[model samples]
Target: MGRMIVSVQKSILVGEVSAPASKSYTHRAVFAAALGDGKCCLSNCLISEDTRSTMKACRLFGGSFEEISDKIYVSGFGKRLKVPDEIVDVGNSGTTLRFMTALSALCGSEITLLGDASLQKRPNTPLLETLQKMGARAYSKNNNGCAPLVVEGKIKPGIYSIDGSVSSQFISALLLVCPLLDGPTELSIHGELKSKPYVDITMDVAKAAGIEILEQIEQTDPTDPTDPTDQNKNSVSAKTGGKISYKIKGNQAYHLENYTVPGDFSSVSYVLAAAAMISGSDVDVKNLFPSAQGDLAIIHILKEMGADISWDKKEGTVHVSNSGKTLTGICVDAGEIPDLVPTLAVLGTFSEGRMEIKNAGHVRFKETDRLHAMATELSKMGAEIIETADGLIISGKGGAGLFGANLCGWDDHRIVMALFVAGLMTGGTTIDTAESVRISYPRFFEDMKKIGANAIEK
Candidate 1:
């Protein structure tokens, strides 16, 4: 396909849309099922480039997938994984690369993990170091702590410590593998953890698969260098100087069962954001579970920005409408809402007052440096944004609106989708590399068009 240019004809967007299945939940559920006993049926699993990468990795571990209607049947390895015959390629999927790196250590043979250009640039050093400490000889070929990694499987489960500030994927990766080990595994995390909610998702999947993980927070005592557990004393909290510990019993089996994936709050944020920005627009997004998703904070964030939004938990729907009222900006903490940053940034450009998005420094290590990419791309469209060390400061022009401009997706799916929403508001925005949306939401443009968004793909 050639490069696509998106423009809108109608300023008002109105329609009902169904949110895509959660990509993060689908990955975890697939992994759980692949490692589980017997045949597992997964409903509402996302079929995307990223999740497909995870499926491929599962096949490498001797698991097989069969699609029956909307449900996927996964025959697992049952804790016995065979070394893949060829290199395992995780194309542009950091979740697949990170999770598979730790899982590969369960096999007795050497296995190599590879990824596309963007995925290869993502840092996996923390995971590699943690696996090595667990008796697995894992390392990056180029020694850059990125992909193209070789793992000699022979994991000796024990206590492992890693810094949590980089990415929560490292913690989740270890959590998945620890229960399958030969001995008990304990993980201690140092530093302030970002993306903590992703870990909650991991724990949810693990629990559903019959795995029990004991978690605790211990405060650090600067005066006492001794172990806090041994002293039986309360120390500093996680906010100040504390560490989170997860203990898993080894030799645990994952029992297979039917699992249903929830709607993706990350993907639907774009729809809600577009509805809130466009005048005379009313949109309803269905099949959402707000409590289970961290990105659902988008609704609360949008409401804080003076947007008309409501959630019907019983119906699992979110309704958003502008109704001729303008959105007002406010300060936001992006630590738990990293996936919503791009869309939130787009909304900020059209809202009133200055929007400060802070605590999202970790987003730089995603498919692209999201913070910098948003600042640069939105600026090209006349947005007043300042990139900071940990976040962004966006000065909304108080409904004065942005002019259409040519933009690039930077090959990031979220970036492409967020820019598309912005394009609907501006009317003449052309985004190159629009195909990147296939990584998560393949029918993003189609869904937007159904909601009266005149996005011409040419």
Candidate 2:
């Protein structure tokens, strides 16, 4: 693909669209299968640039994968990884770089991993420090806590601690490797664990691969009845800034017969938002069965914004239409739902009041400074959005809709897609870095066009 450029104009969308497979689940499932003891088949895996990086990394670690009819058959090395002949290039996939770095500890020799410029800027000090504490020689080659990381093998199992205020990927990276260690491992998380739902996804996938992880939540205030230990208590301790501990037995073998990835709520948020923002648009996004995805909060966010949307959990479908209701703004705590911020920001453009997004500073650490990207790009289209230190404060136009202008995608998939959604509400919008959509949903423009979106590559 060349430097992709697209022009989008306002149009009424009306149709059913299938949500893409979950990229988060696809990454975890593929890694789990690659570490399994036997053959595993994964269905509905998201075939995208980021996930393809994970697949390539898995292959370097002695896993064999064959794709056939939307499914991948993987033959895992079962804790016995081969020292790769070349340096692992994760190619813009932070998850791949982190998870594969942890897995490299099992290799008999040293394994070095690196990524593109955007990914190299992401901090990995928390993960590197944790791995070193766990008896592995892991460090950033540049000594800047960012990538071009190197690790030497045979890490012994023991208790390890990592600061969780940064990316949750550090915690997740350790979760994927500790189960196969030679001895039981106790992992402790300190400080606020940003994006905890992502850790939940990792645990869910590990359990599906026949690995058991015992989780315990230590309340800052023990008197609080909403501790996760209590099955009846469904509230989160994230607001209180609690600690989490995980216990995993050693010498565990991963085994998966068949695993099917779920529909991606993160990717479909743009689709659902388009239907909700435009009048006379009725859209259904299918295959979105609920799991541990934090971005599933989009449906609740939409409903809270007064959008006429309904989600049928049984059928795994989300329906969105105008319904003659005035969409208003609401304060959103984006601590658990960082990925939805861009979509929420665009939705705020069409609302009747102000939408405040908070507790999302971690989003700055993604492939790009998403907070800055959204604020800058949306501002070009005349959106009154304030770029806060941690989040965005979007003041709705009160039906004085924005006019289209030149936008930048920042070479980040989510940023590109969110801007595309904004483009639909304001005609004559031109966006660069349009090719970045291949990182997640390669068919986004095509699918949107099927539902009557006036978008085209020029």
Candidate 3:
């Protein structure tokens, strides 16, 4: 694929655009539907690069997916997954890589899974270790926890535990596959369980598919074998100081038929932030109904930063307007909302005071080290950003002393889109890796153009 460079000029945005389908929901729903017993129809599903990877993976599992009239009809493979004929390439989607890795243990024979460079860099040792404990032969090709992972079929169900600090995808991967095992399984989560809301999304989709998971908070030793790394062995999760236990009975089949994906708050964040920061801008983002998405906290965060933003939950619309008020930076707990860090960083740079984003160490393990990416790219645009071990500290200048400059997208969708928002605030900003937006929002620049943003591609 060819890369593009985008030049964004300062402009006032005003319009109403529908938010895209939730990428998180699409991933879970597609996998769940593919695991079901019969024909399932998914409406409003995201047809992006990441989601398409999930669809392709499902096909390799002996499921069939066809797009018709903007809906994807899935023929599930049930519990009888076929051994894939070729290596499963999951592209750059970490969700697909992790979830498919777990499900690969159910195949009749060995299945190998790999992804692009960014996805390979993401840590998966936590999930691989848990799968090994479940009596499955699972390991990284290089034995370093990253992908090019190989898994042999038939995991025995019993008890398993995983660390939750690095990526919630590990926890969600287990939640997706455990219910279909031959016997009952008990899963434990060690660490702070950062991005717990994503696990909630997994449970929500699983519940809708007639799968039940009983959950509770419990205490456990932090130094257990579940720890993903030896460095974190003795230290307890500072946020919870306890573990989450989940109980799932085996022999349950997924029974999904028709499911509609909710609008994505994560993708719409850039549009909303753009509307809030640019003066005289009035934009409405539609299709954003309430769901298990933690990124919905974007509304509260923007409001706390003094943006005139309101959400009509009933109508599924978020309206943002410039109220002639200067946005002021505030403290943010980013434990539950790592995807919003880049957008929040852009907002902070244009705000009035210091913005402290804490409890975001896991943000470093995303498609890119988002904390470092935002800090470096924004610094190029004349924003004073400090990179901490866990998060970012931006000394907000409120658009003062800010000048547009060439920026790097880090080949990350969130980083690119967030920098686009900052670019709108500081014209003459040019960003590479603009094509990365295809992963989540294929029409991001097109939609921004509809809202009067001067984001031109070259």
Candidate 4:
């Protein structure tokens, strides 16, 4: 939908919702399957911008794919990727650009990683530096840390401590290619890891492909990660370069016969927050996985803010209702869940007090500088929001509901989703562009309508 406007009175929105697939898992599985020497099929893969980029990269690497409905069957020979004859274009998908850049390094050929206009502006310096440390001659073609990375192949594995300050995609990209390393790869992370759960997803998926990683924590930097997940890795000795080893027996192709993607909790935040903002509103969201998605922890955070939430893990769903209960504005540390921060801020806008979010400085480098973007857009909607060096301070009770405000999606999936959610709470229709949601959840707007939300293209 183009120029969608969501206008809803304080009313309960009903109906069913099937969440979008997990982008993290979908991307990891595709790469792992491509590295396999057998046939691997991924069912319920998200057919969004990011995953589509993964599909394209796999094809470029000479991996054959067959689509059976939403499922993708990839037959891969666990040999080196047949280097593409042309430049690989990864459109606005940071995951695709970053991971493929490293995978291309192992291809024994010269491969250039290129991306869309937005991705061209993001940094790929740290990834290049690490690939060099691994003895893979890599550099951005323009010598800037952005896209169109020219990688000269030949990654003879050695112990390299990746500076954990940048995006985890760099670390993940290397980890995916580790099993094929001539020796064990030990990574000494110099700083705190962001998106810890995503790394766990990467490591776990590697293990699933018969690749084992002996991850040992030598020292964890005192900085806060984007997500404080319980998924912890083992600490190994610096002996043997503290090498992490993955066993890929005969480079067997990992084939997932029937794969079911866990429901994306990040997409569910809009529905839940909308319910909380509406007086006497109650909404039931189905097919949510409590065990999956670090952002699902938002349910507990929302419950603490006085929303009635019921979750049945067996049924894989959650029901949220607030029967005229006031949303109490409370302080929260959103560093661990930066993606959810935008949704939380919007939810806070309807609360009665000031909400302080801390340890969230890294939100600046996401699909957009989220802290600035959130503050700017929320201010446009008449919410009193304070921009901060690290996080945000939002004083809610959005002035008798927001006025009709025009928002810039920033071509960021999270911002677009949050703005659309704000539109639902705005007493009048809020206008926004929907192009960015395709980066993560292309079906987000369509799913919003399934929940009985009043949203239509202008």
lDDT for each residue of candidate 4 in 344-432, tens digit (9 for 90 to 100): 88887878788877666767878778899989988888888898987788887733656647777776889878877777766454545
Candidate 1 segments whose C-alpha is farther than 4 A from its true place? 1-5, 219-241
- Of candidates 4 and 3, the better by TM-score: 3
Report lDDT (CA) for all predictions: 0.84, 0.86, 0.89, 0.72
- Candidate 2 backbone collisions, by pair: none
Error of 2 at 170 (Å): 0.9
Best by TM-score: 2
- What local lDDT does model 1 show for residue 32? 90
Error of 3 at 303 (Å): 0.8
Candidate ranking (lDDT, best to worst): 3, 2, 1, 4
Steric clashes per prediction = 1, 0, 0, 7
> Tens digits of per-residue lDDT for model 1 on 1-458?
45655554445788899999899998999999998868899998788888888988889879999866557899999877778899999888899998988888888679999999998888888889888888889999999998899999678888879878788889998898889888898899876677777988999999999999998767554443222112222222333346789999999999859999999999999999989888899999998965556788788778877889999988999999987877887777676668988988888888888887777788899999999999999999889999999878899985475788889889888998998888887877788788888889888889888889887876
Q: Candidate 2 on 1-458: residue-level lDDT in tens?
A: 58888899988899988999999999999999998868999999999999999999999879999988679899998867788999999999999999988988877578889999999999999998888887789999999988899999567898878888898998998998888888999998886788888999999999988899998877665544322222232224544436789999999999987999999999999999889888889998899897999888888888877788898999999999985556788877777778888898888877888888877799999989999999999888888999999989989974475888988889988998998888888789989989999998988999999999999886
Q: What digit string (tens of lDDT, one per residue) describes model 3 on residues 1-458?
A: 99999999998999999999999999999999999879999999999999999999989989999987658999999987878999999999999999999899887578999999988888899888898898888999987889899998568899878888788998899889989988899998876788888999999999999998998765444334321112232323443446688999899999999999999999999999989989999999999999999899889888888899999999999999995777998878788788999998999999999988877899999999999999999998888999999889999878999999999999999999999999999899999999999999999999999989997898
The C-alpha TM-scores of every prediction are 0.94, 0.95, 0.95, 0.89
| Candidate 1 weakest lDDT stretch, 10 residues | 227-236
The candidate maximizing lDDT is 3
Shift in Å, residue 245, candidate 1 = 0.9
**Residue-level error in angstroms, candidate 4, position 368:** 1.7
